[model samples]
Target: MRLKGNLSQIKNSRDNQNVDVELYIDKIEYITNKKDGRYTQPFEFVDELDTPLVLTGDCLARVQDKHLEEGEFAYQVYDKVEGEYVLNPDKYLELTVAYDFDADLTILTAAYYTVTVSNEEFKDIKAERSKEKKQKKGKGRKGRS
Candidate 1:
C-alpha cells in the first residue's frame, strides 16, 4: 500500500519532457488478527524518501503522454522478511498516486498496477564490485626476529 521511490523530470531522446519514477520499496506487511480468522487483510506502502521531488503540470502531462505512448512505470517491490528485502512472486500491484507540483509526493488513491522484480534477480540488477583488502606487510625483522 506504500510507495517509496525517486520521481524526476528528464528529457527523452527526442528532447521532450518525461517523468522518471523509480521506487525503493521497503516492504508490504500483512496485518493479522489473533482473535478471529482474518478474511480481509489490508496493507500500506511506506514512505522512505528523505526529500521528495516536486512534479510540475507540464511534467505530469508529459508523463501521462509518455505512459500512454509506452506504458506504466514498472516498479520493483521488495518485502523485508526477517532481515532482507525478499520479492513476492506477485508481478503486479495496484497503486493510485498523484504527483503534485507544489506538494510532497503522496499517493492519492493507492491503486496502480506495478511490475516487480524478484530478490534474486534484484541482486543482479546492479552488481557492485567488491573492494579488495590491502594486505599488511609483516613488521617482524626482515632478516631476523
Candidate 2:
C-alpha cells in the first residue's frame, strides 16, 4: 500500500525528552495498492507505527480529480484501476496519517477515521502536538518536499 498526503495536524510526542517521538497528523490525498493493482485489500501497520491500524481499501472508487462531476471534493482512498487515483462512490475510507522518522518518512502510519470521530478527537489530539512542534521547531527535524 502506498499513500500520498499532507501533514495536516500533529499530536506531538508523548515523551518530551526524545525529540524523535513526535506526531505528524496527515490527510490522505491519494492511496493505492501496487501489489493488487485492481483489487482493494486491507493494509496492516502493526509492525510499523506507534499506533497500529488496519484499513479497508475501496477498489471501485473512480474520480478524475478532487473536483467531482457535481462540485469540488477532496476524495481520499483512491483506487488505481487502469490509470490512477480514483474512488468508488459507495466504498468509504478515512485515514489519519503520521510518520516514522526512523525511516525518514519513507514509512508512515494511517489510523482509520470517521467524520464523527474526527470532530471531537482532533481537538484533543492537536493540542498535544502544538507544544511539541513549538519546542522542537528549530531542533533536528528536516523539511520534506
Candidate 3:
C-alpha cells in the first residue's frame, strides 16, 4: 500500500531529533484474518517527504509481546531519489511480536514507514505471464502393447 502526506514538523530535543509527518491510508488492513477465535490485523504506514532525507540510524524502542501468535514482521524506511533508489539495511529495522495462541488476549500487527522523496511519482506496474511459452507434451509415450 501507498501513503501520501507531508512533513509537518521536526522536533530536536536534547535526547534526539525526531521527525513528525502525516500520511493518509489509501488501503487499511491490507492483511489480516481471524483464526481459532482470534483476530489479527496488518497495517502499513508510509511518509512522503518533500526534501531528500538521509537515514543515519534506526532502533526498535518497544514491541508488543502479548496476545499475538508467533510470527515474523519487518519494517523499513526507503529513500527514492531522482536518479537512484535505495534501501538502507541499517535503517531497515524489524520486530517480532509474538504471543501464545492459548493466551486470552489478541494480537494486532502494525508498521510505520518514513519515505524521503523529492516528488510523488505514483506508477502502477503489474507483471503478467508471457504467452510465448508453449506447453511440452509427455516424452517417451506410446509404450502400449
Number of clashing pairs per prediction, in order: 10, 7, 0
Tell me the tens digit of each residue's lDDT in model 3 across 9-122: 221111112222322222211111223346543322233333433332221222333553455344444344564445544343232334457884323233333322211221
Best by lDDT: 2
TM-scores, each model vs. reference: 0.24, 0.23, 0.20
Q: Which stretches of candidate 1 lie over 4 Å from their true place?
A: 1-73, 100-107, 113-145
Please write out the lDDT profile of model 1 over residues 51-72, one tens digit for every residue. 4323221222112233432223
Instruction: Rank the candidate models, highest lDDT first.
Output: 2, 1, 3
Model 3 poorest ten-residue lDDT run: 122-131
Q: Encode model 2's per-residue lDDT on 1-145: one tens digit a residue.
A: 3343322221221112222222232332222222368775533211223333333222212223543333222324333568544543433443333456787573434433222223334444445556556776768778778
Residue 39 lDDT, candidate 1, scale 0-100: 61
Order by TM-score, highest first: 1, 2, 3
Give the Å error, residue 65, model 1: 13
lDDT, candidate 1, at 59? 23
